[model samples]
Target: MLGLSADNHHPLMLQRVTLGLVSLVAAFLTVTTFFRVELLHHLLWSNGPENNSSCPYGHFRLVGMKDCLSWLSCEMMQSEVTVMKLIGQGAVKQVFLAHWKGNKVALSRLAVSEFSNDFFHGLEMLKGLQSVYVVKLLGYCEDHTILTEYHRFGSLTNINSILEQEDHRSFNTWEVRFRLAIEYAMFLHFLHNSPLGPRVMCDSNDLGKTLSQYLLTADLHVVANDLDALPLVNRSAGLLVKCGARQLQGDFVSPEQLWPFGDDLPFSDDLMPPYDEKTDIWKIPDVTDFLLGQVEGSDVLRLHLFQLHRDCKRNLPQQRPSALRVVQTYKAVYTLLTQESELSGTYSGTSRDL
Candidate 1:
């Protein structure tokens, strides 16, 4: 009887050991997977770009961006750049698709001599604002033409069409849209704190006009493309700037941006009240809303942004959040949404295993 009892207990002990080993392996795998996912999340969301140290232009460089070239002179641009076709035209300049040293580029020339001031202003802004947030300036011929990186995707207005294509369907996800919005906010933040002093996006009088000021890169990133009307505001000197001499009437413009005097008075630059950079802050929500697009998770994200958008549209410019604050909030919301999604996926996987 004693020998039989020992044999039975021995088999039971072996069974218990096997069950314990299996649980241990399962736990180990779960921990490993969780850590791997966390690492991936960090890598994807972190704004730091690799290979930035080698950038000779002393500006932040995006991953996969080519090395910066020396500013090309008029002779070099004229000799090397072969104009292909006119791709775009704005009030101030005409953009043509051109080939420069085997790489495609956009060559912009003053549309009319009357718009020379605007063209020169844009060129100066391009030279001064050579950062990751702004379009890459390749070369320029003062008062005549300017060359920059060519974005196949064109302006931000073409985003919907680009995403609708079958080959780019995968990029239509909310994650990608939210990333684009974040980049836009980052660009605004960079502009507001630029070395040239606090500058305002004066060209952004409406949604369409605002979208035209930015370009959509091949990699789905947004960069400031037009800076013709970017003006500086000196708050310390109590100086403010106007978007333009004309009256702007629309919900897109901030309440302060509109003509304060009723229809009883005609619009005049002398009578217009110049506004600070807060005008740009007011348009943030509008631009962000457009960038979010209509994707699977966009509605939920918009709901989350309701309060922030409301604050942005506040009647008082001072009440609105700063660009830096807006950028931080966007990043936080992005992180939260991504984590929730990952958690949901993990829970579903665990339920199936059970």
Candidate 2:
């Protein structure tokens, strides 16, 4: 055997050690790459915007994959949708004035317990809607908080309070009240004629009893703030439209709308008569009444409105006017109100000017 020189042996040993280190590092990277890819795939499957492909209008398509991940990840919610203030609270949800992506928004932060499949289903139902009179839902967080377009002027209830106070004057004119009535009628008409079908039931609590449910924008336009709370009728199944666990209440609720199911029974069953679009007709009169109480108009206008109210209040469901017909009648009434306003020089400028 030949004896190797010491210098030559050192070089050989160093080469072997370097090769071993490189091989170990390569194997470790391979394992980590496999897990990273798997984690990304799992996240895409569970929370990506691509899951909303069935959304008819492509509401989620505009958001990129990075933004979609941001929408889904709970870690980023605090950074993205920042709550500015608490605006209002309902029986089921709390409304917050929030800033999302540099735009002012309303965040409806629901109880974590209430963030079940029902809230998600409600989001699915509302995703397809595109209308001026309806509040636009921006996105949702994992914690059951929904972001919507914030109305600058607050709600119709706020307007009512301002009207009641003689000092706070902005929307107190008869023309503004008349215009509000007409616009509210048009809002209902739009909902009743939705592509999702006319069986959609606006929340009973929001419609008649509390004016706060209708939000007033800076433009003086009225938007239905509780659209997410609406109960969508199964258009395919012709099922009874339900307002979730909360039932219709007050003097405006129709007799057919009542059925005690107790706690155990499911509400989608046949125990109650199928609630039709006409259910909304019963509530439209409430808007007219609220408007009339706020303004002193001509006897002719009041009488015509009284007749319209009676028509809407008919006991028989079939006897009530359709939302479309109500819209037409209100338009005619609006024209008369406009002419009177012009004559009396009480025409507060168009909603834009106001």
Candidate 3:
């Protein structure tokens, strides 16, 4: 009692502890409220921002926002997506089968340690597209992984291989090949005629190098799965592909892309051929050839197919027909065959129709 104050030290110490705890709780609540407000503003901006500055190019704005978001920046909750297993590996990324919400999705993971302009721009461009043929981008993870709709049957390349081996009789059917051809042409047409104007949808390597890049959905529809390979023109200003082991070569490479520097000049990265729509156009013939070789029917159909191939491979890019024209031609021939088949028993075929 002598050393203690009038109120007693016990009560005073208890009061000090109570005050400190109260202050701690209040500070915690204040900080938590600020974060919650920011999160809500980001994820639930009901009314779109009035200013352009709120949403800029290459940035991922919310669903209701005035602008879209970059794949890496999308703040997807972990509960929304759960990684299942690794499905594939590519030059720069890994593909995993993941569960997004309740549905199965493909999670393409890119390394965050290295920054890629091409990877970011590709995803940004894909985010803007809403075509039936383009795979849907669900959202993104913090680790720079991209989530998209997964196709069950794999790529066109896989189908092509099976058909080539003639392992499955159903796959070798003329009807299937014809339908695939039409769908492929239509998808390319959609890309070439995009609002962005002839954005190089598919690069030289994957366009015709192998059919496997195209995915065959469970519904039998073909989707351009390698959208990251698609490039946007200068106006969008996002990312550019880094050229390392990717040297333009084989039938996929266009005449303009061929190096004429000769043996004397040193090999330079600057010599890489700049590809455009024509580069894709050049691969059309190869695609047609592969399809025709698989299964063909009727002399008339073969002739028509040959003509389409010839037009697609015209030496000059300008001389080559556009994707729309190619689609029209294929559809016209397809309709004729369908009508004939309806009238007759079935379409006739030759051993070497293509």
- Number of the top candidate by TM-score? 1
Name the candidate, 1 or 2, with the larger lDDT value.
1
The 10-residue segment with the lowest total lDDT in model 2:
40-49
Considering TM-score, which of the candidate structures 1 and 3 is the better prediction for this target?
A: 1
- Quote the RMSD, in angstroms, for model 2: 26.1
Candidate 3 residue-wise lDDT, 1-354, digit = tens: 458776798899999999999999999966855554334322211221122234443343332445455544345636567788988766556788987546677888774436465567657666665455566565665456677767766777666565555444544656557656677777788787786556664444644434755776543446677655665434355433222334455556556555547568756666654545666667776776566553547345667778777877787767888888887777666655654775797753321122
* Residues 76-183, model 2: lDDT tens digits: 556677888888776557888887666677787664455466556555555655455566656666667676667777778666665666553555666566667766
Question: How many backbone clashes can be found in candidate 1?
Answer: 0
Per-prediction TM-score to the true structure, in the order listed: 0.82, 0.68, 0.67
User: What clash pairs does model 1 have?
Assistant: none
Question: What's model 3's overall lDDT?
Answer: 0.61
Summed backbone clashes in each candidate are 0, 0, 10
Minimum summed lDDT over a 10-residue window in model 1 is located at 345-354
lDDT of each: 0.80, 0.62, 0.61
